[model samples]
Target: MSKGRLLDGVSPIEGISPTDSLDTLFLKSGSSTAHSPQSLRAKPWPARPQQLCKGIRGWRWWDSALDVVVVMLPIPFFVLAAAVIFVNGKIVDQEQFTILNHSIKGATTLFPICFAAITGRAAIKFATWKLEQGTTIGVLEQLMGSRTVASALTTQVQLRSFNVIGLLMIFVWSLSPLGAQSILHILYTPVLPTSTASSVAYMNSRQQSYSDPRPSSSFPGQWFNSLAIEMGSMLIAPTEVKISSMDINGNVKIPCQSSLLASGTPDSEGWVQTALMNATSNGSLVWSSLFGIPIELGTKLGNTTFSIESTYIELSCNNKTVESLEPDGQNGPRINFTYVSVAGPYFSAEDPDPLDPWIIGYRGVDITTYNDTDGSAYVFPLFCPDCLSSNFANKTIEAGTIAFQEFEGLDNANATTVFCNPYQRYVESEVSCMKTAATQQCQVTAQRDSVLPHMPPEITYLSFPLVALGLSALLPNVTPIHDATNEVQNYLVYDPLDPLTIMGEDNSVLTSGGSTPKFLSDVALSDIETRLGQILNAFVYGSTWNASIFLLGESIDNLQGHEFGGKNASFVPATRADIVAMIQNQTAAFTVPAVLRTQAQVYVCNFAWLGVFLFSTVVMLIGAITGVVFSRKTIVPDYLGYVSSLAKESPWIRMPDVGVNMDGMDKARLVKEVKVRLGDVSYVYGGYSEIGRLAFARLEETTKVKKGKLYV
Candidate 1:
């Protein structure tokens, strides 16, 4: 054999002796005088042994490569996931302020955390090895030799594969529809606009049309006539004359002609007896004729060509002559008389006879152009008056066109002019009056009763004049105007001292004797009367002769000439058919609000997906850099070097074997015998140098010796 090579392919310098300590052999080789084995046995061990790690895997280029693969493998997957997330983020961010947008943003933030947690486990395991400077298989390597342990362990490799596979799977799943949807929401869901509108609808029906059951107002027009004589030479010039006029074929005419002048005097008793016959023959119109004087007394008016002007008279209460009517003549007593005629019930603003049509119109249309998105709904209102006003001259929607199809009317300016303005004003005034009356009545009624009944139309249209308007003359003969006026005065002029007045107590037939229930609270009754009187005063002003004529003419014209003219007529009581026609011709007008209508939607803008993707890519790169910089190589045990040396040195021994202790033997002797037997057996099996070519050769079994055979 060559001097440089040893048996079993080990070099001579690397070889160790099995029979003796290798240190003793080396010392002997160096000594000049050769000492026997007895002298070597007297030497103690060189130094105490120290506990050190052994047979552990060490750092290698291949191990670093594996760790680098672990860190880099998921980077591409993370990049792909980031791209998808960025796209989803762009989609949701563009749709901001919605619930879905918020959800998508949250998901985008959460995905990274989820990935970190899932892969962090493997990272933690790798970190443990570097931090502790040990491996879980270190003890096994020491017992079985590093070569056997290295081939048996595959834990780290499997863990690296697990993390890579998980990252790839998560990345692939993120591209799915569900994953994308979780990142962002997109749908053409229609949403309501940020505004709304409302409109007023007019009452256009009158099913139960008839006279009011309550005491009805005679009429709303003015009547001009006279109580004085018209043909007679002599008559009384009265303070004022109340006239009762009739509408005969739409013309106002008084049935009786009364004059303010009443001339001639009545005769006394002696003249009555002497000149009664002569006076009757002479045909002179006298005041005695109005007093119901007999012909024998010669007190009668001689001329009977015309009837008496007075409707009623009261002469029974006058016992003296001068106490009677002195207005006709001052010479003798004539008659105490009262003239009844129609006075102004007057036009009421509250109960306008001819109400015009007015209203507000509201419309809600889809505003697709809002936010430049798919579509949204918006609402807006258009006041009819405002629309009709000059402020919207250019914006007025033409009637009868497609835009104004819902409205009922011709596009003629004449019709709109007549109805929209004059009639509209009428209707507005009536409505305002109605509202005021309703409020005032409600207040009074509430004070009297707990629950309010439905307002009666009589109260709605009833006009109670504050002053004794010709209305008192219109009352039936059963009730005297003077008596009512006196009683009303009592109720009007408040006296705090009187309990009955304060209590609103009344003995009048209007409340007593089953006529009607009287109000207990005088305050409440007075308030009601005052309010009603004011409302009537307002009503009477609006119900004038000229107004009545105009209203009647307009009604007739609309019903006969225009289509849908009477569609929105008022339910107000009309004494004449012409008046009803006026109310019927009214119509509530409206215009489409320009705000609700919008231009068509057009989505021509793109999302910021590309920008977001680039940003995410940058973030991913930062993450990769951080991961690479922070990463630590796994700390393999030192047993790897020992295994490499062993493989290089020896081929026969694959592992070290330790024997158990034997019982019933000297412990120290057994230990020495075990070492000596192993050494001798190894030498017999194979020599250190391959040149010797020694092998195990046994001829026969050796004889066993007992304790007796040995010397004592």
Candidate 2:
């Protein structure tokens, strides 16, 4: 035997005794084999027939490598998934930012807790030399015990794998279609620059379509734009045919300044100015592509902000455009080629022409050149409305595109105007060919200025004064305007009070206060009297008191002739002759004494109260009688409202009935046989009902005379 590894092989434990060894063998048998010494064998004998495939084969495949991996890979994932469920349960999003805040907290807390628990278990087991029982520690301690430190790299190696696997799964999730959608929302958020703090931002589908200066060149020289909706896609080409250096139709080689508009006398729509103002009170918003756009002051107010976008002169000119106004002859006809930055006396520091803000920056004619006509793309403009208002004379209004190809001739009267943008367009003169450069295409750019001005549309949320407006919608504006002269009077100067008047000392009160006038001028009074009678024309209508209890159901009885009476069910019977005398003879009816009415009320009230007393007394007596008859359980509050459907066995308490005999012999009988005997048991009945509580007790003491054999 190897002396160095005695306990590792067959050596007995240092603490084990001879008898304890035998006890172990007996316990291993599990048969409770504490029989005689001869019966306790080293191994038990058994015969089995009912079962085959004795041990489960799956347990045989479990090995060290399998255990290590299980402790690592799948265990981590399973643990992670379970942690996710706990994480979901813990997220308390009662506010807007809680979702993001809790997510970070959850990740931080979960990792530390799992690591500490797992490490602590390993440490405790190693110190004690233990599994659940006996002396055997876990594998983690074996790895952590390494002295070289490099040997402890198992911890690092294992954790690195976990991170790599987690990262792989994250990448897979991001590539999914659902992940792409989440990314887009964070990137492109909508907001309206001109609305209040409570407002939202949106460019209508129509306006968005017009926003793109260059769309596909399919519809040549076709300009589509609208004031309310987006700038729709359009294809700009020359209006008249001119076969110069290149082909006219299929692929034309034209100069960059080719006119898309025509020329004649400048029409107002052609040459006009426009100013657009967009602002928001608070909250920083991006209009996607525009960065650092100028924010104006006049339109902004205190908390509000405004943004400006500028673009100028986007059309070719013909000799029909006229002479250059600028000193430089290098400039085109009129002020065309002169990229005028901005005229002075136009804007200032304190209030930049509430309409225009940006100081135009025109680096001469650094034009937007297009090499391929079909290569049009929609790039968002880097400009704000305030800046652009100063640069461009007017709006580059455009319209319909592919998305709106089918919706034409939409009506605004009945159909929802929100979804449609159709134009009833008009102009002062015919569109000039100079604006289009005679390119045989519908280059319907405004004729006068390259862009013409348009008045800002009304910024009303709803029309027709929003159904009802101002204080009248929810409350009356109490503007107490008392009239000096009353035109409409309710009272005549010397008239007597009506017999029905409830106010003391009153002529009908005049409407001389508040908005009602006190004096009636003869001219208006004559008109009123001619329309009315010379006398008053009363506007008669019934008024309701909402004391409907007086008019409906049994409540009508509540109002039964209680003039001043204090009685219940009391009234003097008046004969038909008496009623007849009273009605036809008003003098006698008026003479009826008030004392008689008081007497009627007194009688009725006394009778009603007596009835109530009688009813309450009867109910109390009934409740007392029932309470004494049932068990103590009946008196208890627990069973007051609850009743069992099952019947309980009846209890029998003896009562003494006087016995009578037919002959000389008197006899006694037991009405109930005694079953359960208890001394503290009690019974109750009538006043003697308390004796039912002692009914069984009185039985033994009762004296009874019996006829005995030969008794003297």
Candidate 3:
């Protein structure tokens, strides 16, 4: 190889072309001297790069300033909006609202990150300048030096798409409705003071009740017995009784006073005693004989026993009113009484009638069989008539029967005294009886130490009519009285397992395999029954006459009156208007205003416009970041080719085959040769390689330089 032609068939260009020397040729012809290479070297590069649009003033500064303005436009507006929201307390701590607010705030930081990404092109430019020792941009500037500015202009136009996209993203981030709505909400739709109101949940059908006083152990037990004393006297000398009275509306008033004598007769005790004797008899002959034999053997313990109780029930009127004597006809009533006792198969402390009035209370009676008996007979089981009869007992009483006698002055007075009216003034007595076949062996005698003087006891009956009266009084003209009774019920359920289950002590369990059973034993059931019976008895037997008089006619609306102790049965001292007023006040206690009725209330933190503004601002920032990361071009490393060492040793000029045609060269062979010669030579300066810049720059340089040769 020749020193000047180290590569075969390659040589350097001889000299510069006359056309490129036109500027110097003209200058030398005019000034009589040509510029030396030293003078050219000393001159500065042109202020603007050689490009198609270099003469176009204001492009670079205008473009850059517009981009910066758009990116920064939303900053102040965003700050103002956030400050208003925070200061006005519209920035809620609630997660639902704050999620949107956080997104808006996050978008504010995206601007700087996205701007840095877009400016990666500047980093590329700086790195290329250090490597290539050039002031202008890489390939385009080199081409612009020799070609018309249009070629450089074309290359620059390629980047306009990315720039336009970035600008659009910035514009959206700054001027979107997010900020506008925030501003509008702060200005026009500010927060307002919230009002609180309430509503009512009516108890449509409810009840009120009162229980009675009773003995502690209302249920029958071995020692469950109560004693009550009744001993008082009263005299009413009114000439004539007031049988009934009514208010202005014709509603009856109770407790009319009367003065008429109905005293206990000499035979009253004897009659009561006879009834008690009959009631106490057991129908079994063996039992009767056994009882009589024991009493006869022991010598008549005593004639009989007597227990008498009396009390004066008083009723005085606030306003003095006329009083009257009881009539001497069927209309006038006298004292009445009854007695009952039960004998189970065996002597067990269990009441047959749990609701019986005498179970937990005292009723006056002249008991003929007061003495305890030791029968020598074998008592057959009760509730078995056949067994007793077969055993010569003749008859059996399943449950004990009652014997009663009611005597009124009118019935046996020969047209001289009052009548028998169980509902009004009457005298009554009773004793339990049993009949058996014993030839009257068992005998009993009874006597009364004293008797009652009955002259129609003073009675004060009260009729509440609470439900209908309340409704009719409040809505006198509108709402009609309804039988709201069935709509509601006073339900009390005994849940034995509730407490156990709540405490997690319940034995019952359901598992994947099976269920475990837990139940109350018989003893538990019996104990429960006993307790329940006691409670019920207290509620029943301990109740007072006054309570019944006031509560019995709760829903009644009619004004007609019934007799009670020669007076109205259902009545109240207060007028109907007053009763109605009481009901109104009671109903008012359960009501409240309509607006303040929610279990929990949640108030809006601020206006709706502010939320909209926040959401829109977040969307714009995301868009800008998306464009920066995915759309804009940043630098990378690759190259078209490298200079061959053989070619660099000599001056060379040759054109490689373009893809359009390989000219006579084998395409694969040529490609291999180019790779072998150029693969080791990289565009990147040590440890720094930008594949995108090098590849693009090398292609442009190769096309312009043509076989890697210089013209001058």
Candidate 4:
């Protein structure tokens, strides 16, 4: 072969010599001088491969350390996300929550890109290592360059490949997407409803001082007005409020009071025992009412507990028959009704005639009363004059029936009359309250052994009679004495002196007189008992309301002469401080602590997905470390897949034999001054003219292939 031509049968260029300067070759080939080989050699390479290597052992410690750092960069970001979830458990702040979520998404997205760089380099280095070990060209091609999952899969199937190292390289590449998805699921922020601690305010009636006492006659107008308003509320309040006020299980709730006495019957155990009534019986009285003051003004969402004192009524009744004044009345017509009176053994001696009686005569249409064929009258009386003094003294009062028959000829035969005794008591109770936007509810339970001590005699004497007399005056029916000056029309217009007159005789007068007359016979026994219980409830509840008003230090000047005093005229009103001291001493009031609930967004981690992410990260690190370990065997710089590296070693081109093992970088340093082109480098002439061959070669040695030229 000639000096300028290495391949056999290849034609030499007409004007080029093996010793010609590269500039001359480029000028003859009409190539630009801007890209001349000398210019290419002038540019400096950043780091020499020899300098990067630690003697013959390949890369230095710092180089490997840098690689480790790049691979571990994702660890800190993952740890930060984990730490946020671990510490806060929930993120309530909107800005911080959004920032954390976005940061996590960005980190997961970048994970693939970062992992690809490390693993791609590892793949190339691994291929080079295999090549040095004399692997087949097919395996070398599969591992030589940056590869996608599709390309890796195609190569795996095309070679029917079982090469473990090639499969491992493919697995390492697959981790890019896997690790990204795993990390994406590791940290997340979602909006959810959560209960957080917060404070709120509510009206605590139990905390109010209640020991204050005012003269029975003080602030009569205000007292009467308060009493009237409270009574109206008790009668007309919403059914739900009324129902929530009482605990049927014998429990007590704050802000609400129940008149259903405790389970036992009146006995000698204590005053509380003496106050017990059979609430479960058919004729028992049970009344419940909500306090006029609400527990909380506005809606607050949470649950809390508190303590309070509840005043309620308890009554026990027995059947009895009154004796007739006339002997022939046993065969006369009958009348049935309910009545209230103050004529009992405990009546004050100073005021023998205290007040008018309350009478409710049946209009003869209710189930509570029934008539027998024989002449007879039945009257159910709910009265207890000594109940106040007896409860104050912790004694059971069993005053026999008071005889006062309105009819003359009718005997009290087979009568359903009842002699009922009623008393009031205080109980210490715990309350649980729940509030929402739409509703508020409370649950109360009477504390064990929580019956309170009786009010002081002066206090009870001054307050109880006033309550009784006030109730009598405020009630619906009050029959005045015939000799009185004020002529009040009674619903039953029949003469009280005529015993033969039957009830409902004047129906038009009773029904059409602009009054809704109620008949005991029209009401169920249970309902009648309920109404009676409510009346008793008013007596005690009114006293509490009066006490509350007194404790608040309101002026009571109007009540000076209206007192219900007799022998108890020596009683003095209590001061506000006295009430406060009494309440504190008795521990009758309690302060409750409450918290509010709210909704917020929280940071949550899926530990299962976190495990997968950690596992993938670990696998990636192992692969990168493996690549670094194998790189020690690489004798030349990393240039295995570069087109420039392949160009220098081809036998078809005329180039100097520098060395067979030189990497692309080393070979480029030696041949950068050479100019190259793609064209026809070989051709022959024959009887039928041989076709031209095309390849990359020196510009002076090869001619550009014409577009229409027939060459193979």
Candidate 5:
């Protein structure tokens, strides 16, 4: 309250003093600074709640730009990576339809997105903290001017924790060689092609796939049915990720390729007509898997998440090379480093640059040693940077140990036939593992139409949740509450009056209230609403979004003269549905939900309903009680008291509580008052001492002051 600057290191905290001038004192920023009225920044975009969240102009624009780029850039970048890789081996004379490339491309789209997500998330957090720090300091300045700097510094320091954590997460993910190695290894790992159909139809797995060059073979309606059910389940009920795969199995004997027709076997009504209807008239196709991984299975019909989906599965990868075929099986490879280049730099046996990041040495697979005669083993930069001679030397001989069925540019018949046999060819297998992972592990074999009737179709439950939620509405007896309670207890009936309340809780309330049935008791839902919402999301939103999309491409092909085709005209060859029904008539799909809740909803929803009243009522009371209790018991008074106490002290004297002494006061000693009395002795400003002699000496030339205080 005094007009003059307050005392130093004095009140509120004993033995500790504020600097007589703010520049000399130290104060903590952050929650402590909220007491100051001036430090807080006013809201921006007062009209929109979201915009209002962006308190600073600089921060707002940057966030918007970050979000936009994060959302948009990955799509094009993914396209570019695909375009580059897709035509790598295909673009010689013309291009061939290799759908696998597209799938590989699609999966890869998420790689960049992951990076964008990390960058966006980190930038957003940092910006938020910076903006908040400013706002906090501003508010503190409003309450007490001298403490502003200390408060600002404190808040900024506190918030840096978030950025540190975020950076650590990014660093861990990016730098983790193991994760990258696993993924890259997977990319290079060989994949073998299996018949998409079934092996049983082959009569044996030891032969080449039997192809069905059928013009009449077509899949049928159960696809649409499955599409509808799975989608319905997704839309109505909740869902989750049960990473699984179906292992289908069966056999078929087709008379000829033209007879292959594994279409619409289950009929619109859903039936499994086994025992090939006509081997001569129409060959049956029994499509199924053996060692398949079911990502998703089962179907959700109408209101209930009445889906019998999959056996719970956890991800398991087989990284170990099968010993039976591993190169080491014969005799763990021994690298023979016979001096290939005697004259090159580092002429010693160990070539410094020769595959510094060495390649794995194998026995019978593709092998390339130094081609001494051709000098093909010369060392060079892995990624060519030179304009000319970028492929300075032949670093790798692509045809190491591979034995191709046909050879185009080779003189020796045996050399071209085998992948590579640097040493004399022994009894080792000719071909290297089929160069791809996912393709290798999973074997798909096309079945005979007579084997069952059609290919077993896959079911996507995108619409399951909608059906669950909507049908839940329809079941006057099965509102959301009823169904949930019924699931819990058979005897429990849903009370329509209070739809939110379960029958059990309502009964408890009724009995307790002595017939004046309480509106709702046992109303406590869960603080873990986000978790459950996430669960619901897994069941609901995720199911809807990620569900194996039911592409009911309708053309004049089948069912009611509709053009069952794709979005543009891209063709979809198989409909796994018809094949599924052919396998089992009563085999209803197992539907599961996949959804998760986010942090934002929790903040907004509660704020939307509670409004200021939430804090105005309970929060303030709790805060007041806490402040009173804490202030009395703790060292250094609580926030409210600090505010009130600071109000009485003059501004220019106090400083933040950080361990810095700027005010030139004995920080360890408390002071009762501060005064700048010109005692004809020297006066101190910052660290400078100005006496009669010193003042006269320094300001001899200037007369900016009107015989009193210096103006500048």
Candidate 6:
């Protein structure tokens, strides 16, 4: 073959025979100054045919497009992920959130590898193109073609001079980790509390009817008898049992508002009496017309909070020994009870024509007997009258003249006379109700101290009847004077001052017969006051039963219509249907606005981290596009940085040179059968050999190095 130029501006080494093989020339010029590794010159060979130079170029416009598409593939995935997080700020389902997160994570991991492949290929093309332009294999050139992040970083630091391509290569490789972390951290699911607007049904007492009219002569015979029987059952039931029953039947808890009476006083009972008196005088009592309405039930909200208006009666009393007494011999030795039988201020003012006998007043006698002997015994009678009122304000009452003229036993008598003033109050309160996990609870948060305006007439009318029923059912009856039978016969009466009589004996208070009994002198004043307060509480608590019964509207007609003789009979009590119709005719179903809160897993997007990811993505896309544009004209196989590619045309190993301009894939297919290895490939001169150099060469020419052997 004739000697010719293998590269531009290069010739074979001087005095070298043109007929010698290229390897012989390489070994011969190893010691020469012009052909050293640091300043190597391309070897001469036979000139290539013009047709070979015109063979198909490795890269095409379509190849560049493919590279750009690979780099841009992950962008849509990122956008989709961001949109999902932004659209649904909260994710309630765990599986969907996890699946979305995993998809993003997989994309995040895949993008960097794809980016490196495309850019790394472009980098190899750029380096080869520079060599084709006759540029030397310098540090910047080597760094621009580096594929790994560590090498890229090292190359970046070693760059003492500014080169746009080198800096861009470093920048591109740096984004791998940054973009990955950004994508990984961009979305996270956190458990957070969220609320939605909801509504709940609540008892709206303000909307109930406040009117019930009956003639004075028909008061005891009409609705009063049924109310008394119902009150009787209520009085017999324990307070705790009543409360528990309310909870079970209503699906709601009605907490008592006894705290309204908790004014730090030695005698809370006496304090209540005084307060009630003051309230009645000043007309400051708070009243609710529909006092016994049940709260609406069955709300299916997750966790709700709302406020409602409610009312309950509170009772207080004062019990003390009478310091002075005057007697009148009407029938027998007894104390007479007296009070004006008129509805309170609220009722009288609001009623168009107030019923005359709606309010109850006592005009009866209580007799006491000591030692069962006429001369030696002392009489100390106590009487408690039904002083029911429609008014929630303060009021006072006084006892009538006692029939006993004198005390027979004087200072030595063991019995003592006692007086009691029981006070009832109408409490308007703001109750807060919360329903969580299908259970509802209510508590009285505040009470109205001053009277509210526009008291419902139904509340006033029902208040008198309720108080009267409570008093009669729970308290011992007082004996009235009979004109025909002037003889006053006392029956066994349970003393209200005795706790044992109230709590220990089931039949003591509920079944006790006629006249109010005398309080024993041995009973403490505190015990007397406590027992009176308890009786009053039992009276007020009857409203809870009324509420429950009213909730059982129309059903009671079936249960009690025949029991009351007949529904339409004049002697029959007002039916549950009548009361329900009277109250609910004009009212809308009560409801209140509430906030329903529930815990959910929320997809929170960290835009700052997302911005970093997008920044890296945009930079990488620009870099990839730039690479494609800059390497469009390259005309060499993708042979950079590959040991197999390096083995071709190596001085120690001979191979055909026809594939230099072919694509790497085509070249790889052609050389798939060629075997190569990293081994000893030392040059021998004048029968002397130096340290072996490790290089990839043909299997026939190379010797596999031992495991422990070292080579240059």
TM-score: model 5 vs. ground truth: 0.16
RMSD of each: 31.8, 40.7, 30.9, 13.6, 38.3, 14.8
TM-score of each: 0.20, 0.16, 0.20, 0.53, 0.16, 0.48
Clashing pairs in 4: 217-559, 218-559, 219-556, 219-559, 220-559, 252-444, 366-521, 366-522, 367-521, 408-499
For each candidate, the alpha-carbon lDDT, in order, equals: 0.24, 0.20, 0.24, 0.43, 0.23, 0.41
Where does the lowest 10-residue lDDT sum fall in candidate 3?
286-295
- lDDT (10s digit) by residue, model 4, range 309-380: 444443333433343332324553443332333332222112111122222211111111222343222233
**Tens digits of lDDT, candidate 5, 631-657:** 223222112213223322434223333
TM-score head-to-head 1 vs 4, winner: 4
Cα deviation of 189 in candidate 5 (Å)? 6.5
- Alpha-carbon runs more than 4 Å astray in model 6: 1-68, 76-92, 104-112, 118-145, 154-199, 210-303, 309-440, 444-588, 591-593, 598-712
For candidate 4, the per-residue lDDT at 499 reads 24
Please identify which of the two predictions, 2 or 6, would achieve the higher lDDT against the true structure. Answer: 6
Candidate 3, residues 543-640, lDDT tens digits: the string is 22122221232222121253211212222223334323323222211121222111222323354665655555455444334323321221221111
> Which candidate achieves the best TM-score against the true structure?
4
Clashing pairs in 6: 210-457, 210-458, 211-458, 279-393, 279-394, 280-393, 280-394, 281-394
Model 1 local distance difference test score: 0.24
* Runs in model 3 lying further than 4 Å from the true structure: 1-333, 336-602, 605-611, 630-632, 636-712
TM-score of 4: 0.53
Please give the clash total of every predicted structure, in order: 35, 86, 45, 10, 133, 8
Residue-by-residue lDDT tens digits, candidate 1, 168-283? 33343233223333334222223222221211112211111111112343232221111111101011111111111111111111110011012222234111111223322442
lDDT (Cα) of model 4: 0.43
Model 1, TM vs. native:
0.20
